[model samples]
Target: MEKQTPTLESSSQPQLKLAYLRPGDMIDVEFASATKVRTKLQLVGFDTGRYLLLKQPNPRTEGSYADVLFEGNPVIVRLVLEGEAGECIAFKTKIRAVTNFPFRLLYLDYPEQVENRALRAQKRVRTHIPVDVTADNNQADNTKKLASGVIVDISSAGCRILFKAQNEGGNVTHMNIKVSIGSGSQKDLLMLSGQVMNQKKERGMISVGVRFTDEEAHIIEVFDHLLIDTEFEC
Candidate 1:
């Protein structure tokens, strides 16, 4: 439906092309509007040198997708892609055709790809350290559970971690985090309240994107340690 196609700009649309996109890469679609309704979709395949065939989208019922992305309509959509190094890139595309034969897909022909490197607000240092984190939930009677995870990458602003935890009816939203930075006697735990910024679930694991609400000095201290340690290990 509408959630998959790119929304066209009535003013001026740039020429965007991404020669690197491949099938199975995840993308987030956004409508080109004031609200910019967003939805998730996956690349199914491409029509050789013609267009990209995306898995049919689940459109929101309230958007202007019907008026814009209909047959023969040159609609523009903003696509968000994450690089292998975890950088996000946004591309603007025009939908050429909607097909049903072969498989359900929306064909995206040519695109004007662009990126704002400033979106990554901080310098990221990749690290591998088992971090023990625990947070109390106000919704759960102030009770919290400890979760063990590995800090994948960290910055002064936040850190990304992969964790496996059992959620009680998806009650894994908010918590006051105590992030144990290191292991053994070298371990230093930072007490910070945080909320889940973004998360992706796989099996029983959740990869959490956490934005620290802690003091800047505390997070910077951890980031400094990670940078020094990672450089030494390298």
Candidate 2:
């Protein structure tokens, strides 16, 4: 059997009337709070009914704030964009934070969908990609300066890391995280400043959620290529 080739849609014309979002576009959302929490969300699915389905980059445990409703409404969110040609993209589905607390901001990737027309129909394509990560903890003892942790997963804006720590120290809400991407021969490293958005303590295990800073927006492209390539390869 012959391998099927994927089709590329024209990028010249804009399909959807979405604000700050285009198909295959990744963006970060910031929340208002003391911690300045943020999460990574991916635009996996969409509904023309003024809403889109955003997949949470991390998984949440039971009885967590992510399980509860936001603003007295369900955890499902809708993007209410303002300005000329305002539009609303509703996400009627529930999302789990993969963490314990709620982060104020979220990073999201919007994928475009094709609409069926008189002569052409829409089809779904898969892409595959990979991400590289490096995290460090400055709180380690003075003599032993080392950061210990492994990234659980990553999206366009942020990532979830699993670290081993016994307790929280004083004045340490942010950490230095580095991420990179590339295939066998080509690799690119990106340095980002992140803050601890949420912490979960269980015995000897600690999971932390972190979001990228405004200056780190450039890294989203590396992540997007990894995701899209990974999907296609798979």
Candidate 3:
């Protein structure tokens, strides 16, 4: 795609806002100059308002561009947009600020598998989840160790989770988990085993997708309840 740079005058600053954003949705932004600005924008810290820090590339964008560059860094952006209609509209002026509406995080309302089966002929559900991951190699030892990860999404057959690398060799195949669900009185925790199916890198993090083993039917049943009974009011 052709990149463009924004024309910023001394008195006027570029207005920036996050338009059409959702919690799990991916977005792309560009400058008016057609320079194809590249940076890692994180939904990191949020106050009553949504604030973002643009981790500018080293060496920075030079010249009389947006006073965007300060102390060898790009100006941090504070964005606020609404979650309604799956859009977060943003604009900028001299003092950069997001417009349109206030931004809120979104969670999928329905099961991803159901949505996928209806939309694609292949009937595959591929969604990413954020998790804390780890691995252990001493299976024969008496110690019972566990790796922790959050269930990103669940289907009738499989699930995906994010986790930290347990070993340097990257030869993880089998794993055990103790998953805690709900909170307080209704909270439930279960132990299960699964086989790692794939691994990929995202935003400098390693994510592992797993398929539950045959012996873990009970764990799958609990997932079914969580996916079906929970009413997500996004």
Candidate 4:
């Protein structure tokens, strides 16, 4: 799908953290903020401190790919790495002006600065399953007990749970809740420290926005797929 040139500051643009990119990594690239069709490209090689060679994502049109790249012109790119979909990086860059017999690929100028920001509309899904929450992982708090809640919505980074309105104690704001979500064998029991970013009370129902804290990247990756594929069935 094409993307609208984000109507935000350049600072919020995607910034490539070299740590996330490698020679073989692939990135979705868009041209000129005027078009939304992003081209998938592979990082075939780089000239270290100079330029980068990328395998074009689309077929060569009637015109030369080099002409389309608009050598020396600025370009924008998006990267949705693993489960970090909550945080996508869209940046502006330029393809170098050099045109030689690389034969089948295009070379780009090394990004001096790529603005990194969240996606225009982050990937979040509605979950109809109930999620069990243990406010305190410590079983010692038999008195405090698990707070039963239904997961109303979920994202790659966190979930929103609908719970009893009375549980809006101040302590629940950043409480570490062991959330058990999903159904049947596909169910997953995970320990997530919840950051209650928002809370709403209506009709005796309390919906709390909980951001899962300190989850390992790999775990988030697994959750992202499940939330998208299983829970949301998308």
lDDT, candidate 4, at 146: 51
Clashes of each: 11, 16, 28, 11
- Tell me how far the alpha carbon of residue 53 in candidate 1 is from the true structure, in angstroms, after superposition: 3.7
What stretches of model 2 exceed 4 Å from their correct place?
1-146, 166-171, 175-188, 214-217, 228-234
Candidate 3: what lDDT?
0.37
Give the CA lDDT, 0 to 100, for residue 201 in model 3.
Answer: 44
Model 1, TM vs. native: 0.62
What would the C-alpha RMSD of candidate 1 be, to one decimal place?
6.6
Score candidate 3 by TM-score against the native.
0.33
Best by lDDT: 4
Q: Weakest 10 consecutive residues, lDDT, candidate 4?
A: 225-234
What digit string (tens of lDDT, one per residue) describes model 2 on residues 1-234? 332222223222336445444343332333223333344455544545335444444444322234222332222233433222223343322222222245333222333442212211211122232333344554333222224555565544455655566455322346554434444534544344466665554457655556666354465555444443212111
The TM-score values for the models, in the order shown, are 0.62, 0.31, 0.33, 0.41
Model 1 spans > 4 angstroms off: 1-50, 55-64, 79-86, 99-104, 110-116, 138-141, 164-176, 186-192, 202-205, 221-234
lDDT of 4 by residue, 43-122 (tens): 77777557777876444453344435656656666665432234556656677754445455767777666555444244
lDDT of each: 0.58, 0.40, 0.37, 0.60
Query: Candidate 4: what lDDT?
Result: 0.60
